[model samples]
Each structure stands twice: as structure tokens, then as C-alpha cells.
Target: MIEIMRTMVSYLGSDHKHTALSGGDHLTCEREQGAKRHVQCSNTPGGRIEQLEPCIDGWHCVMNFMILIWQKLHKDSQEDYGTLSSLFARIGCSKAKKPKNDMHTCQAAFLKVFKGHIVTAGCKEFDIEGHKEVNQSLLSSVAQTVVKEFTVIPEALLGESVIDSGDKVHGYARVLCHFASLVLLFVDAWKEGDGERVIRLWKILMLHFHAEKKTKYALEALRLQFQLATLQPYLSHQLTWGRFINTHGGLGRNIPCDLHNEHINKLYKNIISNMGANFTKTASTWAARSVSSLHRISMAFDSPWPLTSRLTSTVKQQLTARGQMRRTSRQL
Candidate 1:
């Protein structure tokens, strides 16, 4: 794996082909210092290993590795648990397939890859047919390594003080919600067009996302939500009736406030209700940014803002009218 990663970096690292005319007849090789800096190190299961040994573009390498890992994991999953009750029997629950709490499969895979032991709680003996002992052991070892490298740090969660606990919980809820939204989007994209590759990407992305959330993965989940929103309509339509999306991006006319405005409004309500008076401006701003980004992306797919000024005027007028009605009612 190290050799493979190094070879990839060698091919991607240099800008030797780039040349600039320094004089009338002389062509001097020019290098892109920024690109060189951008890919200085690679993030791997082993952590940041070596920086001087040909800088491995961390983002690119990780992305590529994620693609590879997802492919391998997906293929392994299909082979192991693609059947109906087969998966439930192995993982002990149907919900294990959920991208957020894939503890079962993750545990299994971690064990398989690193520990070399598959711990089965209980299942019909028939379900274990053709299970080679050797393969199971190998997979368990790999799984152990993965679990150690990526599992969340419980200490961090426990360290939050009572006064600021809401922030931590809100952050968690936001991440899970955003993750569900993105997974749904990927599913929707696959349902729409050209989603096979996207679906395959979920495994690695989920792993990395979860790993980051453990200690230092702030806002990655939110950022991913933005990226996914712009790419495909995960939260495009109401997942159910009476659902609404939120207005996102900038305040502009002609942006129909996103088809999913109802959902966003619902989310806002839930967030408010849950957090109550404790909701901070930071949380509000985070939610607002979500709405704004969605609106901006939604608008891009439709008409340019021609009615923004008109809409703003109407909203202000309505609010003013409502205020007057309340004042009159109070006086009465």
C-alpha cells in the first residue's frame, strides 16, 4: 500500500511539464509552488507518516484511498451480506446498514482486517455455511486496525461542561442530520443518474466522517452537506408530505426558497424547540448558513433574481402589518 501510494504521488507531485519563456529564445521550467504545498502530506490509517519522502498530497491520496476502500468494502459486503436475512443474521440488526451507525459491519470489517477473528453472537448455523476460517481471521485483523485508527474519542464528548453541553449536542445532531441528508442525496442521485460511483463512495466517506467527528472533525459534516446539496437533490423534495426545505444562499429574488423549504422550517422549529432559549447565535448562524447555501444552489438551477427586491419589500410590509395588528389588539 505504501509503495502504491508513493508511486501515485510521484506521478501527481511534479509540474515538470510546465515551462515559461524566460527570454526570447530560452524556455525555463517553471514549478507550481502552491500545488506543491497543497499536497505536502497524506492522511492515512497510519497517520501522517513522512513529509520529506516526496510529499504525498493528503487530500488527493485520502480521496483516492477512500475510493479504493469503499470499493473493496462494498464488494466484500455484497459478497458477505447482500442477501435478505443474511445481513441481519451477521450484524444482528437490519439498521446496521445505516451509514451513520454502521457499528456492526464496521466492527466486523475491523475485526476481519486487523484481529483475524469474527465474533458471532448467535445465528442459525446454516447461515454460517462456507465460511472459511482463514479468511475470517484475516478480515478480523484488518478490522481491529481500522477501529483503533478511526474510532471516536469518548473523552472528548465527556469533557464538555454542563454550561456548553447544548453546543456539543447541537453539533452532533447537526452532523447526523447532515449525514442522513447526504446519504439520502447519494441514494437519490443514484436513483436519478450516474450514481453508482457515488454510492460506492459512501463507505469511505462515512468512515472518514465518523473518524473526524471523534476528535477534530469540526464542520466537515456541514461542509459535506453543502457539497452534496449543490451536487444532487438529496433534500430537494419532501421526504414526506407536509415537509418543507429551507431558503439558503443569499437573499435574492426568483429563488423559490428551495422546494424543500418546509423541511428546513421544520428543522428550524425542531432545533429551536429542542434547544429552547439555550440556542446560541452560533447555532442560529449555522442553520442560517445551511438555508442560505441551499437557497443559493437551488436558485442556480432556476431563474436569476428579478423579484428579490419585491419579495423583501413584501416581507417587510407583512411583518410591519402584523406588528400593528398586535399593537392594536394589545391596546384593545
Candidate 2:
């Protein structure tokens, strides 16, 4: 998802020179340091990167997508860019002088911004009109807020008729909303353990990739399709190792292999940071072991509490409301 999002931003944004396809065959994009890189874009059999790497968290995918959209708008939109900049600022994401060139700044800003959007029991709706408090933590809520806020840019620029506008910026915003909606639906299906629905939505997402193939983003589209093809089997069968736990007591569904690895990496980083940057490797290992033990102990103690149930119910209600809004919007 990160790779796909990065490719999309690079290809779709105003930086055309960086992502030129070579020989109309393979995918080639210039790296940050101006070096040419080639990526296999064919449908032929190859090693899937996800198979070897950790699954990126769904939130990370959405975050990257949101940041990419912001970057795109910063580059392309002139009249309404300030609106987005102000909206981001409301969430503590300060506007950078050069949003397109300073990706690190954009990323850092959104990370802080997302910290407030992390799923929690007291999540609140994001009101664009009043710039209301955004305290939601559910993945769906974040996606919904992203769609609403991003849709504002085009709407502000092209008015209520923005949806009918043939402008490039409008198209990008619409694509962003569509992608976010699909991802939220995918997450809902995955949480519900609905493998069929997951596969269906994934195919729909692949269709978007297919649509991009005829455009300037053809190489990126092809490369994305190739990289994500491996997940089809796992999505279809829902039987891929310990990651796909059938027991409802354990995460309620299959946790992607990457989530676990990423969580551990995050935990390790947090632990190291807390250790004040001068700890020995052995000390860090022991500290990590202790933290793990304490975490298990705390979970065991909290298992009997009703807080978990309440939080779950809250999340469900939020998701249901968001789903209804999506359905209503589609019908209209």
C-alpha cells in the first residue's frame, strides 16, 4: 500500500520527469537523489514483496494516501490550496513552505495529525463547517473524515457543481475519496471475517489500477497490480498460517502478518527511545522482555473488565453510521 501510494503520488503529481517509463515496457522512476531505478511491471511470475515483508498497517496506508493527496493539491491547486493548508493546521499540522519538496515535513505533520484520529471510545465526528473537534480513532472514521475534508478543496474551488467538473484537481479529489471509501469497506470486511467481500472489494480496487494503465500512470498502475497480486490467494482462502486465526477471541479475524511485525518494531523503537539512547543491547533486550511480560499481565487483568466491550460497541456504532452515510451518499 505504501509503495502504491508513493507511486501514485509520484506519477500523478506535477513531477513528470521523475516517473518516465522506459521503452514502454518496464517501470522506471527517479529516486530522491536523482538516480534512475527500474521496477518490474510485467504480469509474469515473480517474488511478491509482501510475502517476504511485513504487512503495512491499514492506518499507515490511509495516512500516506492523505499526505499524498495534500501534496498533490499543494502542487496543482492555487486558489483553494490555502483552504487545505488551514484545515491541516487545525489538526496541528503546520503548513510548510514547500509541501511538495519537503515530504518529510508533510509526513511528520500528518503523523501528529493522525495521533488525534487514532481509534478510541470517545471518537467524535469531524465537522468541516464548524471545524469541529476530530477525536475519532476507528479506521473508518479517519477515512470518512479524510474524504469529507479533501472533498472540501474541490467543492470550494468549483462550487457545489464540483462533482460535475472535468478539472484534473476534481478528478484527483474524487479518486482519493473513492479509494478511501473502498479501503474503509475493505477494513470492515476484514474485521467481520468476510473473505468473499474482502476479495470483491480488492478486485474493485484492482479495477482502479486497470483504469490507470491507459493513462500516464500506466507503469505505476502495472507495478501496483503486480505487487498486490500475491494477496489474492490469501484473501480468497483466509487460510494463510497463524495470521489468519479463526477463533473469535483472538482479534476476531485474520490479522495481517505485517501488523504483528510492525507492532513489534514500533514497540522496540518506543522502548529504545525510552531507554535514553545509551543503553546496551543486552539491557534493551531485557527491558523489552519485561515490557512484554507486563503487557501480558495487564491484559490478563483487564480481560474481565467491561471497558473492552464498551469500546467495541462504540467502534461498531461509528462504523455503522459511516457505512450508512456512504450508502446514502452513493444513492444520492
Candidate 3:
């Protein structure tokens, strides 16, 4: 998803074309400004602005949601700042500091609070003996973990609607929670390869998304919805062939290509970084080849038969534990 968005951004350059009015002093100023700014403008009866809207991927979708959550929390804090501060303090998020415009801080802070909530609720609801902790290693997908955990947030923690509307009842936080839960349900259906359920959930989610247009993050929400809509056909295609191609005699699950690509990119960058800051392309290529050859030699020496089995078993264990955690979370 990140790769796709980057490609689109590269394709569409920084300055987009726009139309402006003509036959006036404003037209002269517009032309002058266009020439000065190195932007193209045309005279047309009706003005058109070429706006580029990038598709929001899962990572960005969650990040934007976190931003909205943070904004709403702070807005509500104006009424009872101490209450909000204390609530987050319980999760080790001291000092309700305003996050920067980047939204990374917002995501990290909210994720910490959400993870804490999930751990506390899970321990109590599952009646686990001893001091058990959630296996953080199992949560490889931040978006999935966030949406899944959000479904079970205690109602007491979701404060009342700070927006004083005579017609509306539910607050933005509650609505957003429902939306995230719907997304998680949709993902679950997709994982199960239930096409009908996936379609149904998609429709329901679209309806809810349209209803959320009145919220503060309406444009961001719309972008997320558009991204989901655009990916539906691609997701359907994956669902169709995923099981057959990904499994060996119906043994394994389909790995997400986006995550796989991200992992590979990270590995490549790590390798490049290890070779110092100023390595040529040819040198980097040789370095990668050398590493590959060394890995193959090591595998040959260490017996290749156990390697595959070991990886498969490790993956299976992790998947099993993750599934158990999800089931427990749903039950909670």
C-alpha cells in the first residue's frame, strides 16, 4: 500500500493544473502569479482545480483514526482535563501533551493506551492465573491490533458527546469505535474467504462511512473509504486464488503481500546500512550476493531439511497464539 501510494505521488508532480477566470484584472494577476510560481493555469468558463487525493493504506488509516481520537479526547478535555489526564495516566501516558502535525506521536500514544486497555480487560475477563502478559510479538500488524482491540474498549472510558447537538446522540469516539469494529469484522471475513460476508460488511461499512461525513475528520474518513473501495476488487482477486497458491495441500495460510514486501524492503535497507553510508550500487549488489551465498552455504552445512520445518512450526505456533488472543478479545 505504501509502495502504491508513493508511485502515484511520483506520477503526479507537485504542481497540479488548475483553471481560472478570464477577461478581468484578476486574470492578469493570476497569469502573473502562475508564471512566477511556475504553475500552469488556463482560462475557462468554469474553473477546475486538479486536486490529487492519495489512497490511504492500512497503516495510514489507523494513524488518521488515532489523530481523530486524540483530537476528540483533547477537545473533551477542555471540560474535565483532570479526568482525561488521569484516565490516560492509568495507561502510563503521562502529560497530555499535544502531538505534532505528523500524527506519529498520536498513533504511538493512543496505541499504548489501547494496548494497556486490552491487556487489562483480557487478564480480568479470561480469569488468567498468575501475572500473565499479552504476547506483543504476536502483534505484527499495528492496524489489525488497533482495530481488533478497539472493539472491546470499556464504555465507561468512552466519554459522552462533547459536541452539543440536539439531533445527534452518539459521540465521535463511539462512532469511530463501531467503524473500527466493522473494519475488523470485514478483515476476519476476508481471512475466512467468505465472499458473501465480505461484501455485506463492505456495504455496511460504506453506509456508516457516509454517515460520518459530519465528523471533524470527514475528508480523511472519505479518503479511507475511497481507498477501501478501490482495493475491494484486488482483495477479491486475492481471496479467489489465495488458498490454492499460498497453501501446500491446504496446510498454510496466505501471507499478505504488502507486509511481505515491507519486510523485504526493511531487510534490504538494513543490509545497505551495514555496508556503511557511501557504498556504490555495484558494491551493494555484490554485498547482497555475498550475503546470499553465505546464507546458502550455511544452510547446506546446517542441514536444509530442518530449516523449512522449523520456520513452518514457528509460524504455526505464532498463528495459533494470535488466533487465541483474537478469540479471547472477542469474547471479552
Candidate 4:
């Protein structure tokens, strides 16, 4: 999985080409900081890779990379930055200035923060900014805000009257239904996927997403809406999906969850913020911090990405299911 992910990253960055960087008579360390030494980097990709190994290893910056794509496509008339823009808040995809205590916050401003700052620092549209502009401190601030406000309102800006309510509701339902469909697709890829429980969860999400899409809604005719509401735990965690509560429902399958990786990234960024120092000078400190922040377990690098961390919160319902099973057996 990691290798596949790496391949995608390389492809996205156009780093797949292995070209000779430079042939030098000697290698020399330019500066010494603590036990780490900095070497002069040549203009070639190989030279840059060697120079950047300290910052890049063990950490994934795919989201930021995707933002680069989004920014380019957003400005260009040819691409579908429209759909991506719709995924974010205020059409700017930047963080909301106020606390998202209400309905209007989608919290999708992570890329916005960097894009805004980098642009402020002279990164023009479709122009790649220098690595120097990738400010750790700025990123750390934006990371926390994005996590805090990161949201997706499945239903937003629906019609006012009940006559047109179902249109928006059903539309939002379709959006969520499509997501469930994708999950089912990957579940097939994984093989031996537990379809029944997942199907139930999806139906529940679909129903809620539809209902939420309306200015006001009620299910007078449809069957099992009340039951599904009772069974569903999140009750729109996307609206309330802070770093604390977002991972609740996404861990059903045996495979690794995307939210698992995302939260780990958020945690890493939070630690970066709390450290309260520029990592530019102290980037060599990343490895030890990786042991503490990225892994966040005694097993550390031994365990896979999410198998351990997700088990605790995600499987509580399984225990509930088991207890219900025992009670059913006694009743029988």
C-alpha cells in the first residue's frame, strides 16, 4: 500500500524520471547544525532529492500537492476546479474567519491558507512556489484551523418551501449514495468485504444526508427512517467532524481508513504548531519526532498505519452487537 501510494506521489510530482543530477569531484558539508550537516544542493533532481530527504522522508504532503493541482485547475478555464471548489467553503476554499458554531462553515480552507500565504509571498497563478515559501509555522497554523473547521455540509442552500425540499434532499442523498457506491467498489477490491453492516451504515448516511439537504424536512411516508436515525451514531459528523469526532463511523471495513491517515496528518500538523519553533533550522529533528508524533504508539513503526489506532474507537459497535446477540440468545 505504501509503495503504491509512493508511486502515485511520484507520478503526480513528475518525479518518476531518474536522471543524472551532477558529477562532482567532491562532496562537502556547507554548514553544521547540532549533529546534522547541510550540503550544497545542485540544480538537478537527484541533488534536490538528497538535499530534501530530511524534510520529505516519512511524512506525506499529498494534500498540499493536491492543492497545487486545485489552484492551477481553479484558475484555468479548461479544468474542473469547479467541482473541487464546490467541495470547500465560501467558494474560496479557505478557512472561515470565525468559529464554525453554525451551519455556514465547511472548514475546507487548508489549501486556501497555504495558497493565500504563498500567493501573498509572490506565488502567481499556475506558478510553482519555491520550497522556501512552504512555511512550517504558517502551515501549522492553517492545519489546526482546517482541522477545527474542516467540514462538508451534505445539504446546503436548499429551497425554502416544502414543495421543493425533496429535490435538494434527494440530490444530497444521491451524493452520499455515490460515496457509498465507491466504498462498495473498494470493498469488492479488498474481497471478503462485510457488505451487510456496511450497507446498513450507508443507507443510514444516505437518509440523513437527504434530510439535511432541506431547509426543513420530515419523512412522513418512507419506511425505517426513524430506525435508521436511532441506529446511526454520527448524526452528521461531517458538520461536527473535528479531529476528535470525525473518525467514528469511517472504520467499518478491515482495510485501512482514509480518515486514519488524514487524522495522523492533522496530529502531525498540530504537533508542529505546538512545538512553536521554525523547523527550517531544526528539520533534522523530524525523525525522532516522527517516532513520537506520527506513530503515536508504543509499537511505533512496527504496526501498520491505522490497524491499531482505529480499533479502539471504531469497534465499539461490535461489542454492542455482541452483547445484543447474547441477550437475543437468552431470549430465544
What's the number of clashes in each of the models?
37, 4, 0, 1
Give a tens-digit lDDT track for model 2, residues 22-66.
111112222311221122343421212112222222223323344
Q: List the residue pairs that clash in candidate 3.
A: none
Quote the positional error of residue 158 for candidate 3 in Å.
Answer: 21
Tens digit per residue, CA lDDT, model 3, 284-313: 767655664555566579884665533543
Global local distance difference test of model 3: 0.41
lDDT of 4 by residue, 1-332 (tens): 22322332353355534321111111111111111222234465433333121111000112222222333323323132223233232233333332222112322243333233323223222234332355655666654333222212223332232232344423332333233333334344223334344334434444543544421111211222343344234332211121122223454334323324544556666656666555553553473358344554645557565664445454322223233323222221
Residues 92-144 of candidate 1: C-alpha lDDT, one tens digit per residue: 33333432234334323322221111122111122342333444555565654
Winning candidate number (TM-score): 2
CA lDDT, candidate 1, residue 291:
64
Best-first order by lDDT: 2, 3, 1, 4
Candidate 2 residue pairs that clash:
55-258, 118-137, 119-137, 119-138
Q: For candidate 3, which ten residues in a row score worst on lDDT?
A: 18-27
Error of 4 at 170 (Å): 10
Give the poorly placed runs of model 2, Cα more than 4 Å off: 1-63, 73-173, 199-257, 273-278, 285-291, 298-332
Which scores greater on TM-score, model 1 or model 2? Answer: 2
Q: Where is the poorest 10-residue window by lDDT in model 2?
A: 19-28
